[model samples]
Target: AQSVTQLDSQVPVFEEAPVELRCNYSSSVSVYLFWYVQYPNQGLQLLLKYLSGSTLVESINGFEAEFNKSQTSFHLRKPSVHISDTAEYFCAVKQSGGSYIPTFGRGTSLIVHP
Candidate 1:
């Protein structure tokens, strides 16, 4: 089974500052990585993903993450953040196969102070 670990439980950053949410995983086989964001009351939404083809992937919201197989890490980063970007971020991992189930991290709460 695969497992995900989020280094920090909370990150406090001011407006217009770059943020990086660290994520690491352990899996015996090849796996896919994903970053999901959860708003106040909404469900988890996909922020970015690293499937195959490319080692790096970016979201439409200006967040990017690179899949490093050797290091078994996929960290999410954003150049500049806004107060609206404050949310809970999660790192998920699942084996590459027909299974759609993913093991999720505890989640990192990003507080974008103004």
Candidate 2:
């Protein structure tokens, strides 16, 4: 089994400011971690994932997440945030080849202020 934790429930930042939403995970077995973004009144969209190969993964929209094995963390970072970036971000984890269903953490709400 795998457990995911999102450090902050809410994050406030001004437009174009650098921001980071932390995520940590613990599991007995190898796991896959992902970051999802949910805009208001919309479904979750894949932001970035750390499945294999490089520890770092980036999204097309300037968001990046790095998978750190030693720290057991996969923190998401954005150098410059925009107003449209305000949304709910969720961290999810699932045991590799164990279960297709993933366990998600309580989402972190990113509030981009003007």
Candidate 3:
């Protein structure tokens, strides 16, 4: 089945601490990669994407991730995070030659302490 799996459902860390959210996907064909962030009571925003190029990609913010074709994984990371970074992150994949709608992981919730 086309799906994405996020290893950690929730991560709690102190303010300014670093964090990483693991993501893995299984697809039959090539796929587009994306990481989206959603703050409380808001819509999802595109954090980064790995369309076609070097496996590594970064967001406008400080988040970054690498797309590994061999392992079929894309893990997100951020160093020295702020409390404002607390939010839910989702990993998604859109299959090539298929609908544009992406299949997303359950989601990883980041809790930043003060």
Top candidate when judged by TM-score against the true structure = 1
Tens digit per residue, CA lDDT, model 1, 50-75: 88988889999999998998899999
TM-score of each candidate?
Answer: 0.97, 0.97, 0.94
Off by over 4 Å in 2: none
* Alpha-carbon lDDT, every model: 0.95, 0.94, 0.93
Best of the candidates, lDDT = 1
Error of 3 at 43 (Å): 0.8
Please give, for residues 1-114, the per-residue lDDT of candidate 2 as tens digits.
778999999999999999999999999989999999999999999888888999999999999999999999999999999999999999999887654899999999999999
* Candidate 2 colliding pairs: none
Ranking by TM-score: 1, 2, 3
- Cα lDDT over the full model 1: 0.95
**Model 3 alpha-carbon miss at residue 94, Å:** 0.8
